[model samples]
Target: MAEPILKVENLKKYFPVRRGLLGALRGEPQRFVRAVDGVSFEVYKQQVFALVGESGCGKTTTGKLVMKLLEPTDGKIYLEGQDVTELRTKEEIKAYRRRVQMIFQDPFSSMNPRFRIYDILEEPLLIHGIGETRAEREELIYKALEMVKITPPEDYVNRFPHMLSGGQRQRVAIARALILNPTFIVADEPVSMLDVSIRAEILELMKELKEKMGVTYLYITHDLSTARYFADWIAVMYLGRIVEMGPAKEVIDNPLHPYTRALLAAVPEPIPERKDVIKEIPIKGEVPSAVNVPPGCRFHPRCVYFKEGLCDKKEPQLVEYSHNHWVECHLAGKI
Candidate 1:
């Protein structure tokens, strides 16, 4: 098998929940929120591998971990077979940053309100010392902006973030991520903040960029429909664990995990052909706290097919049910 462009193995991030001084003095054991318990996945070159789940399910945390924005409590992140998580030297880390970039969820807040668009896009190149002269830097910035379809870069270059619309600001954000010529990008809900009308355009622009540059994407999102549309492969995460994963169409057309089925049920059906297969809400209850995740199958409490004694007592391991399709549930193949 060809090596993945980016890979994560047993990724874990646990944020300690600090106690009061009195509790500390009492010698209480520290508690930690298991934001990303044990996530494992890979992204092939030029592929959009999406991590989809509801809010607080650790989708965003996983993205941050892959980007090295948050140091992992334990795990390995490899970029082209090199373990970046162990990088120590300043130069090594700098090189890693240049190869990997992020497009944040909010277009409005991700950019600096004070900096001009030119400065924002040029910051990466300047920091990396890529352009020798001012003219060189300006040319690089113009090309990046033009790639994202923000035409006449000169007109927009001097304008501030507040001057651009939500869609245009997001285009700037994409241009910023692309300026460094990154090989991989962790796009955390990049289009969620845009208006419905503009979301398709932004997604299409990203697709074009991927094809043009051969850049791989770790697309983090909560919307299954968007995930299905944007991703080549899909991994459904819950309570920091991947419950199911496979090719995008197979996972969307024939989900096996109850949680995955429930998620698909929640997506509004816009076409008549899918009406017959849309399962009714398969579970009830809000997502459980990550700090105190339920024992056994983390999803049993909310799963419609929860079994007595079994599902609540032992967690299921991820298993392949068909060609390249994997699912984690006791009911796999049986359901």
Candidate 2:
């Protein structure tokens, strides 16, 4: 296997929940929302690794941790085998920042309404010191527009955010990220807000860009259907922990973890025979508060196969089931 372009080990992020005046006076223990608790994964060079889970499951939070948008409470982040988490110097961080970029989920909010598309794409080039002059930046911006397939580049370059459609706005976002020629990108649900018809086109464009540009991606989304089409590897996240991960085809075809199976079951299938196989894995009650997570397995409360003593008392470690296939479940081998 190729050496990973990005590696995350025991990554964790916890946001402190402040108490009100009355509660503060009572001296309530400070609580933290465990947004990403001990999550670990790797993205190989030029690979699309999809992080999938329902909302509030910490997929977005994990992405932010990778980009250093939100600093991790614990654990180390390595980029190209360098320990980036320990880079404290201003110059060190500034140099690291240029190699990593993010494409946010909401295109409308991510792009500035005031800035025209040209300025939006040019900003990154200027910030990164990629272009010395206005003419040089404009040339790069036009190339970026063309790369994302925004035709005639010049026409779309002058327009504001409102002049473009949802998909077009997202293309601009992709262009902005690519303007610097970043090695790795964290795409946080990049196509979720777009029209269904245009979703495929955008995904295709991204895949094409990967082939042409050799960019690695941490593709975050709740859409398993898109994961099936795009990701080379899949990691199933549940309540801030990755429950299962493996080759995209193997994991999707033969999901080891119950949570992984449940997620795949939820994906709509066109085949009539396969439709009958989609058994609804009923997760009783809502996701428990992250502030006070359940003991042992975080998923035991909703897992059907959860055994009382073992699952509730002993937290299962992520163990490899086969080459490149891993699962975090007490019943992994037994199942």
How close is every model to the real structure, measured as TM-score?
0.96, 0.95
Clashes of each: 0, 0
Tens-place lDDT per residue, model 2, 179-212, is 8888999999999999999999999999999999
Global lDDT for candidate 1? Answer: 0.92
| Candidate that scores best on TM-score | 1
Off by over 4 Å in 2: 271-279, 333-335
Best by lDDT: 1
Across 117-148, the per-residue lDDT of candidate 1 in tens digits comes to 98898888889999999999999999999999
Please give the lDDT score at residue 179 for candidate 2.
Answer: 84
